[model samples]
Target: MELQKGAFYLIEDIDPEKIFTAEDFSDEQRMIESMVADFTQNEIIPNLEEIDHQKEGLSRSLLAKAGELGLLSADVPEEYEGGEMGKISSAIITENISAGGSFSVSFSAHTGIGSLPIVLFGTEEQKKRYLPDLATGRKIAAYALTEPMAGSDALAAKTKAVLTEDGKYYVLNGEKIFITNASFADVFVVYAKIDGEKFTAFIVDRDTPGFSIGPEEKKLGIKGSSTCSLIFEDAKVPVENLLGEIGKGHVIAFNILNIGRYKLGLGSVGLSKSAISYATKYALERQQFGIPIAKFGMIQNKLAQMAAKTYASESLIYRLVGNIEEALHGKVDGREIGAAIEEYAVECSISKVHCSESLAYVTDEAVQIYGGYGYTQEFPAERMYRDARINRIFEGTNEVNRLIIPATLLRLGMKGQLPLLQAAQDLAGQLISLQVKTSSGGEVPLEVEFDMLNRAKKLFLLIGGTAAQKYMKKLAKEQEIIEIMANMCIEIYAMESALLRAKKALAKDAASAETKIELAMAYIYDAFPKLENWAKQAIAYMFESNEEVRTNLSIAKRLSKYQPINIIDIRQKIAKKVLEAGKYVV
Candidate 1:
């Protein structure tokens, strides 16, 4: 299985000369994005209050309307009465529709985890039977994996499925909790242990006997989306309804989860942008101290921080989407597609962690900027704050996703995919020489920032590679070290992504991309200190010997070196632009 080529597989693999930005959206993608925006404003936003009230069937009804516009089938294959639109198309749809508040959860779940399992792992017969209705959203779909006993440890599910003596059906008896879209889904992709041992996936219809949904859960946010428990009281399902291979349900569960994590990140980006727009508008309209609050430095700070992080998150999300779309292109088989997406599992986890946290921060700042009105239900920030909380908790908690990042990194290194060992050895040699090359005059704009990013990548390789060598297999047990690596990776990826996007803009027309350059500079300058601190902490904790610590710290300080810029001023500049536009300026 050859891993598909992409923009970059590792931090060191980033090409300072190469650029990939979201600005290059295709005409079709833009059209789809515009259509989704229109639908979100017309069909979803006005009814947000009613949907959040859980007006019976309101969420599903809006999904049906979206489906009527073929919004739900963007990623489904054309052969299955689906659109077969590219991944970015679907990502844009998800991004635009995310402004609809809680309905975004329902829509994303239905289109992503709900239907994609069948799209990627289902049998031909299964696709023929289910994809049509799911594609059209005539019958909503739900994924049931989390159980009362199993949330993060999904395979620890107590759900049991046994084949009957008639050689026909599997009697499934278990309960799945906190299931999205459970209230009105027509089909469910459920996970259970076969004969109380092998984990397997099954496609069960909502009308299956003994299949019942528990009452809707009262939630902190996204109240408009359906959440309930699914009870399988000896639910009899046909043998052919099984999805993927028996005893291999983890494949489906994890691959679908990878897709879910990144899509959730994209949703976070959209939500953060919405929050910034709301906050900026509020600041402009709500005057304080005989002037608009937008004039205040503190308010400007909050707005700038929100836009900066949103800019970084958006850059990275679309970059990953482009990578996945390229990898999955021309692949017809489900397993092949799954393999393609799994190659970038590390990036997927990074997107999930970084973007979700960005959204959380953005929403918190939005609430802060809105002041008293922000806390009240009268303003959108109140709901934004609530809805954003769940991103950090779900799609694998940020903690869990953080652990996955370093684990996947090590796996890729061991597989010779990332060349970490070689990079570390080379950096160690260079450290002895103390001869790091700095950018010269006549370099491209922001070349110094790019050089600093490259050094940061080397810093990561130095620390992470050394940790891997020292801890060996025991690194898995060192959660703290793993988290440090994850944070370092997150910062590096976000900074580089913004840089690449900004450079792409410069490549197009440097004169008009000043904001893009500012976004990159502000993000990189803000991100460097965090990466430096994380590197120092990891080195301090992992290196017990004093000489080793001193040497590594010296090398780290050298590699992490950068000429400081006034991020506050750049941020103020960014804030002024955001305020002028009344949204995320980037």
Candidate 2:
């Protein structure tokens, strides 16, 4: 469906059956979350200002403390010094600790993208030598993939590894930029060009003769997290240090990035919820117009919008995580895990973009809610605003991510891999063909709307398919853009699925329902118009010519059907729940 510019979608129509609830969280996972949350509040929050001002390495003591609590080992196998929990558990911990600010970046990098290479690509010996120590936080791990010229074109790294005449070791020479955890890293998973044509990864130690770290960088946000350049001057890495076979670095990089995307989304959710909570409480306490600002319709509208965004993010994350977990059951080995992760690259990319964008929107509105105080350092919203900016830029710029999503969807469609969408569409068609009566005894005809939706879906498929075909032929230059379009399509598809799910739920329990159902109805009512607008925009951007002002104006006029709800009020309601829970409960 198409969505209009500046129009808001309601989520009240979402099915409780499909919605992720607290029951989905395992007791052990919940316990871990509690520990991380308490630890962050007790340890990190008080010291955040000191750490940021000092611009020092995170105190080694804190790392050791996290290790002791098993926070550093959630994703590692039980055979090592790890808790052996799955990605969902790791996500929960990451989200909770994000409230700790910059420290969360450091902690997540240490446990996730940093350590994953060893677990996925390392030899048994490598795992034995490093996983235990790394898991226990006795040794810090770093991943070096981005080079001066190879930011998003990760495969074009200039770092070279050459074999010695005796074949005893490979000599490495290269530099890596924006390497997180570089300052105190004990080991690095380095990717380098091999034989001038292939990229390979290696494990390098910090104390190696030719290994050195550049000075720490001053960043826009996440200051407490160390970011620096790594220089490898003729560093000798043993052949055994190779992470995987030659030319296979792409596998390791892509898989780890996929997982990273999910983790990043989880972190965004936490920060967004925190921002909403802070703004809501401030609104209720800060009086304006002779009452709490939240009592005003405008403020309530913002609150509602915030809550709706948060709900969408939360729902998508849990759904994707559950799907990944189900797909990965009994598949614990590296190759199996990598394959599973690669299969969901599209979903991961979409989640990353959606959650990051959602956080950005929520934080912006939050700052607005706080009025003058939100811009001042005296409040957390300002800091959150700064911190939230990076989520869209890093891991892969949202622009690049967008291309990945639509391109991946196109590929999946061509291969008939996305059966769910087809099934959903078929069901929608059946429902549309069969007329149904509303609870008010009114006959509702959805056939026309369904036809429009079907046409929109076809348009998306065609545009996405054409883009993929053109881009893949010139992949070296257009891969990033391809990813952006791919992501956009995936998001469109997901929103459509959510709307469908919401409709089915309402239809099933038209007579007997509770408050959740009411909320679902409100959400669907609000969401449908916006979804339609988005679809129209997507179609216009793809098929409409530059001179097609008539088409553009028509789409714009279609968007005028719904008045803008008071987002401030909606955000306040969301904020109250967030404040009451002290975090994002959903």
| Winning candidate number (lDDT) | 1
Write down the TM-score for model 1.
0.97
TM-score of each: 0.97, 0.83
Regions more than 4 Å wrong, model 1: 1-11, 15-19, 434-443
lDDT of 2 by residue, 1-586 (tens): 1121110011112233543333458788788878888998898889888766644545556777899989899888888888888878877888888888888888888898899899877788998999999999899888888999989889889999999999988889989999988888898999998876789888999987788899989988887788899998998888888897898889899999988898898899888878877887887788986988866767766766666666566656766676676667788577887887787687687788888988999899989989999999898888899889999977888877776765555455556765433533453344335332223223442323323334434434433444444455564355544543454355443454343443444455643322222233334345445544554554454454666545643543443233344434434554455445544433
Predicted model with the maximum TM-score: 1
In model 2, how large is the Cα lDDT of residue 394? 75
RMSD of each: 2.0, 6.1
Pairs with steric clashes in candidate 1: none
Q: What is residue 130's positional error in candidate 1, in angstroms? A: 0.7
What do the candidate models score in CA lDDT, each in turn?
A: 0.88, 0.70
Q: In model 1, what is the error at residue 19, expressed in angstroms?
A: 5.1
lDDT of 2 at 376: 92
For model 2, what is the alpha-carbon lDDT of residue 152? 81
